[model samples]
Target: MAQCRFSSSLLLRLRSARRFSSLPNPTTTQNDAELVSNILLHHHNPFHAMESSLQLHGITLSPDLLHHTLLRLKHNSKIALALFHYAKSLPSPPPLTSHAFHLLIDIVAKVRQYDVAWQLILEMDRHNLTPTAATFLILIRRLIASGLTRQAVRAFDDIETFVLTRPTAQDFCSLLDTLCKYGYVKVAAEVFNKRKHDYVADVKMYTVLVYGWCKIGRFDMAERFLRDMIERGIEPNVVTYNVFLDGICRKASLHPQDRFERTIRNALKVFDEMSSRGIEPDVTSFSILLHVYSRAHKPQLSLDKLKEMRERGICPTVATYTSVVKCLCSCGRLEEAEDLLGEMVRNGVSPSAATYNCFFKEYRGRKDSESALKLYRKMKEDRLFAPSVHTYNILVGMFLQLNRVEIVREIWDDMKESGAGPDLDSYTMLIHGLCEKQKWREACQFFVEMIEKGLLPQKVTFETLYRGLIQSDMLRTWRRLKKKLDEESVTFGSEFQNYHLKPYRR
Candidate 1:
């Protein structure tokens, strides 16, 4: 039975290895340079130009010229394919080399025309021409890049038939990475163990497996792979340890409702294990533990980790400071968070958008709009962290609540000028505020603008508009808007389920 299986496999390989295409000689163009120039000039209309060149101008299609033209349209698959089809339209098609065919296949695959590309391969096979291994490798990699990992695996399965040379470890690693990326770690592991004897297992291969195991929360299997590497005399590097540390920390510190304390303890144990294994903890190691401590609300422990990193001559990264800042903000230590922000800048670590958002959120919660505005100006002046839509939304909403319409308008204008263009929520808030103030005309204008921008106002937004129209006695305007909205299939309803609208107690 084993002999029969081997024979069947051999036959499959031989059949798959048969030539995909063999083309007879085609007509040649007199002036290759002139034809190429004409093609280049009309690359945007590649197919049309190719047709005109052959059918109208009586210029024969040259494979070399077609190859050059296709290269120019490499980024645009549709145009390249059009040119390809035009070349094949001639009585004697231009002779396409293996590289030319590979380029066309790659361009077609990039645009996700897999069916058409497969048909091209079948046509190639009909012509008794075989593609090179490089061609298959390019196709496989592109397929994986396009998130067609299953197809890539199929391609990988039959890759042996295309390439004449031995497959490299890099090639196998790419396939393993793709498999692991899509949560096929078990299959990847099986393939690795089975094929490790065929190709020498490099550190990257081991790392890929360890990462895959850790990614799926299979730390036990990850540790087993680590031990397997050690047994084979392959020492786990800092990257490998970081992966393990990150996994353990993610489990322990992230979920407060879970066994948070136990997880933190587990993470610490992994950290200590790294030290015991003579692998010195790096910046990433410290960052992971600090993040765990911060998320777990252990601010003192997080601060201590920061101090330890500093004394050890390991300057804190932006992430390390950000974690501590976030912890401080969560604990309502606003003053300390502010001071820490200054210190972070002194240490040459710029605050990220998240850092600014955290402080802005706290300030808005406390109704300290003055402080928030100052922080906003400071953020703008610093220009390190560009303000996001959330930042603008908070400021706009706060100003509206304070009945500062002019200030809100200024901020809105600034938001637009700053390139953080208003989103649906921004327009909603603005329209709601304007309606509350009985500014029906202004509110209607904004509503029109929102609709023009393809932003559908929520039911609350329509309610606000309706109430404003009733209060302002704009029945005609309200009727027109209602008619338009109904025509657009917009149904008016209550506020979003997540939000409860309170009634006015007179």
Candidate 2:
């Protein structure tokens, strides 16, 4: 019986080695690329030409090849599932395994096919495959990311039932981190309390719970945990203190009208409290201090802290430098920002997309699209990193401000092709920018596309489009949309609510 067992151990290794997307890997050899393209060309074939390609290559179905092909075709679920079914039916080496099923399950889950995902999970039993912790993590993380926190909780519950094993501390910790990071801190606290007795509660576990409360700016609850943990004899660590410090800054950010000096001073109190407790500040603590000053737009103070790090023989991270860079950029000190950017690169620190975005924003402000696009060209040549959604959003906004609709459209398509896909902000900015340019029909098209993609447009998005159509005497278009809403679109949770149109002279 043990001899027939199959798992995702090798599959996990393969997955870790590759990026997750439906795009072909850039590093593939010409021959391998040709084979992938050939097999994918016949993706809709019922007989599964993937097997024929394998036979032609005289290569048995290996885990590496299987993982590669599935990821490459992830967007085409029909072909990916067909490949999975063919692999399962194979009576030879590389027999049906948990990895194939899990990968397919994740693919379906990405498109919100939860029922199909659950069925795939159940089907694993027929193959004598046991779902592992990684499997549940994928499900839980995706569900939470999709704003289905309750469904994530259900997946957490199903872990013990499906895996035939008890949930580990790591599983619980991961769930808590996901939930808290996504603003489900209350639910995370409930889970922690519900299972406190199942394992030996330690400082780390309590710290996770404390971090969750502090994460959401619930200092009262966080302090309660500190007292409770101490009473339980579990001492708080530097990380626990750092959570409070970070939370203080996060809370300060919520009220932009507050005095920057007062906010910065109050945020530093957390660090003072840490020292009073005999907890020495670590690199993270200094990073948080830099964030404190940066958040208040105090670039010189931020730079002072960077110099202090060197004076104390402490090495600063790329993020540390980026904070000052960002602060300088926001303050219109582009030369200083550039100096720091070059200094970080000289120190062998690679700037992230966020670091690059600071410069783009300054150029966009100065209407220097030439310099912005030039920097993007350089970024395209840099193989180590790629543009992310934020980068695309900046470009979209920059082009839209110049009324370069065609260029904005090209950027929209390019960002989508890059595979990060548009988030809510992307769609929102694009639609409104189109409306501002009197492109009502195009704006409506994107608004509906946003809805179809499972992203709910803001109330303001609908209102802006409505006003644009009405003010432009595009009543026919407005009537068409209203009819569509009345006949079909309202059922989609009335994504648009009842709002006063106010589309005419009052």
lDDT of residue 500 for candidate 2? 41
Residues 1-506, model 2: lDDT tens digits: 43112212222333344332344444553334335534454424546545433332323445556776777777877666656666666666464567777788889888888888888888877777888877888888879878899889889888988887988887888888888878788888888788877866777777777778877778789888878888988878898887767766665662464666666776677668778879877778788888777767788888898998888887788778878898999899988998998888888888888888888888899998888877877777765367789989999999999997877887789789889779999999999899888899999888777877777778788788887887888889988876755554555664545544554641
Predicted structure with the largest TM-score when compared to the true one:
1
lDDT of every model, 2 decimals: 0.74, 0.76
Per-residue error for 420 in candidate 1, Å, reads 3.9
Query: Model 1, range 139-159, lDDT digits (tens) per residue?
Result: 776776677766776777666
Clash statistics: count for each candidate: 9, 0
Candidate 2 stretches greater than 4 Å from native: 1-60, 76-79, 91-93, 108-126, 133-165, 254-262, 368-506
Measured against the true structure, the TM-scores of the candidates, in listed sequence, are: 0.67, 0.66
Model 2 lDDT, residue 274, Cα = 76
